[model samples]
Each structure stands twice: as C-alpha cells, then as structure tokens.
Target: METGTLYIIGTPIGNLEDITPRAIRILNEVDVVFCEDTRVTRRLFERHGITTHLKSLNARTESLKIAEVLDLLKEGQSVAYVSDAGTPTVSDPGSQLVGSVRNEGIKIEVIPGPSALTAALSITGVPASEFLFLGFLPHKKGRQTQLKEIAQTKRTVVLYESTHRIIKLLNELEEHIGERKVCIARELTKIYEEVLCGTPLELRGILENDPQKQKGEFVVVISQ
Candidate 1:
C-alpha cells in the first residue's frame, strides 16, 4: 500500500474564526489528528463541529509514538499534526516526528495559519525586514547569556515571555540594550488584546504602576 501523507495544520492562536476554510476541511478529512494537547484541540474541534479522531503527540512521548504514527501511515492512514496553538513545531513540538516520517520517504505538507509571533510583529508596526525569533528564553541557567546574545543582534528581536518573568526580562533588556525601543503585545487576538510601544524603561514604569497590565502571555519586540 502507498504510504499516507502527513499534514502539518496550523490552528488559531486565540480567536476561533481565524481558522481558514482549507484547514477546517483538512481537519475533517484526515484519518487521525495528532496534537500536543488533545484537550485543547478538542475545544477547537468541538467549536468547529469536527469529530475526527485525535491522538496526543508532544515532546514528552514523541519518540515512543513516532513508530506507531509511522506504522499508521504505512497502512495508508492520512494523519494531521497540530500544536496547541499556531503551527506545529514552532517551539511547540513535532519536529522529530516530521523528520522521522521524511526519513521513511513519506510526504509532508505544511498548512500555514495564525502565528502569534507574526501577528504581533505585523500589528506592532515594528520594521521586521530582518528579525530573530528566540522562541522562549531559558528559565535559569544561561538566561543571562541568551539575553546578551539578543542584545548583540543588530536586527529586530522577538521573544515569548510569561507573565511571571516578563518584568525581569524587561529589566534585563533595559540594562543591556539601554532604553531601546520596545513593543509589548499581550493577549493577542482576544478581547483584551493590547499592544504597548515604548522604551524598555518606559514600559517598565507603566507596568510597575498598573499591575493588572502584567497579566497574560507577552510577546516582546525590541528594535536594534
């Protein structure tokens, strides 16, 4: 039997309507859907009224499950891989599975959709002719090293930061980059979506005064 194809589907980051028609069709037609979190994907599926079978495929068990997924493909079962949000393998997981499937000589296709990084960059009006996406900074060890590396980059830099460490990261950036222009995109595509632009020091003061502004995931953009 001919090997089945692997579809890397991209889902919406926040707003459900952001999903494209092609993505919904593929989701409904695929024999099985592999996602980082089945529970999260289930919400999307339920919202769209899609009832396709879903299997959990994340960094934790990707190695153990790749063989099984490959086996299913060998049996001519079409499968789709999706992350909890946005495109799969963009700091989410599933790169190993894609590599292993390609090694097996099976076909793979990417179905692009909403990405928080691109969405944040586009709306921020920050020049992104050349930019670096440092997915998530190290939590402890080498954290300073990572910040220093970002500081040296001549082009714009984008990073994903959690609510807990955003203030600390801003302080570090201010210290190393010295009042560089910065943009913070928080709760993107949702009801509370906010885009704040200012120097690192300025943003720090504003966030410090309004503690509520510090809540939710943050996308930090720094201009060189």
Candidate 2:
C-alpha cells in the first residue's frame, strides 16, 4: 500500500492575508490538521473558508498524539501540521513528529509560507546572504555562553523574543553583544506592527521609555 503524505505547513505569523493560496488549498484538502493551538489555527482556517478537522498536537500532547498522525498516514490519509503562528518546527512544535515520520519512511512535504525570521529579515535592511538563527535563546543555563558567541560573531544574527523578556534581552545584548545595528520587528503584519532600528543601547532606551512599544512578540536582527 502506498503511504500518504505528511505536510509541515507554514501559516501566517500575524496578518491572515499573508498566508499563501497554496497553503490554504492544502489546509482545506488535508484529512486532518494537527496544530499547536486548535483555537488559533481554527481562526486562520475560518478566515480562509477551510473546514478541515483540527487535532491538537502541541508540545505537551505531540508525543502522545503523533501515533494518530502516523496511523492516518499509513492508511493513505493526507495530513497537515501547523503551529499557532509562523512555520512549524522553527521555534515551534512538530520537531519530534517530523523526526518520527521520517524514521517511518513516510512521505513528508513542506508548504512554506510566512515566518517571523524571514519577515524581519526582509525589512531589517541588514542585507546578509548568510546569518545564524538562534531561534530563542536559552532562558537560563547556557544563555550567557550563547550571548558571548553572538557578541563575537561577525555575521548577522536573528532570534525570537517574547514580550516579557524583551527588555531583559536588550539589556543582555547591551552587556554582551555590545552596541551593534539592531532591528526590532514587533507585531509584524498587524495593525500595531512596527520595526525599530538602532544599537542595543539605543533600542533599549526607546523601549524603556514607551511602555506600549514593548508589547507583542519581537524578531530581533543584530547586524554584523
């Protein structure tokens, strides 16, 4: 029996309109959509008029729920996995599922769409052909070592930062990475979206003054 395809789909990070038509079509046709948050993904599907059944496959449940995915694929069912925002497996869930699917020799495909990493890069004006993506820096242990590494690198660096830790990250960057050309993209593609460009000290000062600007997810670019 021929195995079915497992699609790792990339959804929008903010604005729903950013999603591709191809991604929409796949989501509509897939037998099931496994995602980080059913509530979040459902809104996207609803906006696109997609009615595919959604199954929860977040970090907590992915290991236990992945069997359902593998079983469906073995039965020749097409499956799609999406995160709450952006692409799956990039600072998101689905790594384990993808690894397991590959081990089973099941067909896996990527429907590339919106990603915070690319979104920030396109507007950062840093213009680097190559850059190291750290995803999210460690919250505790090994964090300082990684910061040191970032400080020393001559290449562009990109990473995600949460709203709560945005200030902390900027301070750490100031301490370790020193002053460099930093671009902070907040709430990309949304109504409140804005990008701030400056050195770590400059950006940190700006953020500290305007408490409102510190809100929302951030994609930071530190130019070489």
Candidate 3:
C-alpha cells in the first residue's frame, strides 16, 4: 500500500476569514483530521462546508491517538492535523504525532496559515529580526525564573497570555521588566482586534480600569 501523507494544516487564530483556501481544500480532501478540539474544528469545517471526519488529538489524548493516526496512515489514508487555533506545534499539540510519523518515513506536509505570534509581531514595530518566542509561560514553579530571564534578556520577547492572567502577567512584567516597552495584541483578526503599546505599567492601568479590554486572548511583545 502507498504511504499516506500527514498534512499539518494551520487554521484561523480568531477570525474565520483568515483561513486560507488551500487550508480549506486540504481539510476537505483529507481522509481524517486529528484536531485539538473536535467541536472547534467542526465549527470551522461547517463554516467552509467541509465534511471531513474529525477526531480529538489534544494534549490529553495526543499519546493515545498517535497509534490510531499511524494505523490510518499505514492503511494509505491521508490525515490532517490541526490545533484548536493557528498553527500546530506552536505551543499546541502535534509535535509528538509528527515525530512519531516521521520516524516511520511517512510523508509530512505543512499548510501554513494565521499565527498569533507573527500577527502580533507584525504590528509590534519592535525590531524582531532576532527574537525569542516563549509561547506561553509556566503558570507556577519556574514562572519566577522565566520572568527573571525575560527581564534580563536583550532580545525582543514574545509570549501568549490568557485573559484571566493577562493583568497578573502585566504586573509581573512591571515588577521584573521594569517599565519595558510592551505591546499587547488582543483578539487578532477579529472585529474587536486591538493592540496596546506602552510600558507594562501603562498597559496594566489600561486593562485594570477597562474591564472590556481584559477579555479575549493576548499576545505580548516585549521590546529590548
């Protein structure tokens, strides 16, 4: 049997309109799709009228689903893997599955699309020719150490933060980074998309007084 290919497809981070035509085509053409959330992918599929079969392969079930994906590939069935949002393996699950498939000499293809990391950086105006992308920082344990390192690092640093902890993270940045220039991009590609540029303290004050700005995912870019 011919070896089936694995398509690492990137989907929209926020706005559905950000999805590329090729991504939609691959989603429609693939035999099966392994996604972080079946419900989320289903909504995307439904939006584009794609009826591809989707199975969950999030962090919780990534290990358990690897064998199933391998079995399908071995049977000459192409599979597409996608994160809940944006590109796979960008602080999302897909690395283990891709690594397992690669070891067996299976074909792997990447369908690029929207990524919050790049999206935030695009408007950051910070020289990001060489920068460190921390993705999401640790909630505890090494969190302090990581913050300390970020504070000392000279390179532009980018990280993702959740709505709930964004204010706390901003405060932490103010403590460690000490008035460093920070840019927060929230709800990228969405109708309410916003990018706030200022020192950690200034942005914290904005988010603190305005409850609405506290909502939605955040991409933080700290300049050197």
Candidate 3, 14-127: lDDT as tens digits: 888788899999889999999998999898988899999988899988999899999999999999999989999999999999999999999999999999999899987988
Query: Candidate 2: lDDT over CA atoms?
Result: 0.92
lDDT of 1 by residue, 1-224 (tens): 99899999999998888899999999999999999999999999999999999999999999999998999999999999999889888878989999999999999988899999999999999999899999899898998998888879899999999999889988998899987899999999988999998988899999999998999989999887
Pairwise TM-score winner, candidates 2 and 3: 3
Instruction: Return the number of clashes found in candidate 3.
Output: 0
Off by over 4 Å in 2: none
What C-alpha lDDT, on a 0 to 100 scale, does residue 140 get in candidate 1? Answer: 85
**TM-score of candidate 1 against the unseen true structure:** 0.97
Q: Cα-based RMSD of the predictions, in order?
A: 1.0, 1.0, 0.8
Using Cα atoms with residue i matched to residue i, what is each candidate's TM-score against the true structure?
0.97, 0.97, 0.98
Predicted model with the maximum TM-score: 3
Which 10 consecutive positions of candidate 3 have the poorest summed lDDT?
14-23
- Give candidate 2's error at residue 44 in angstroms: 0.6
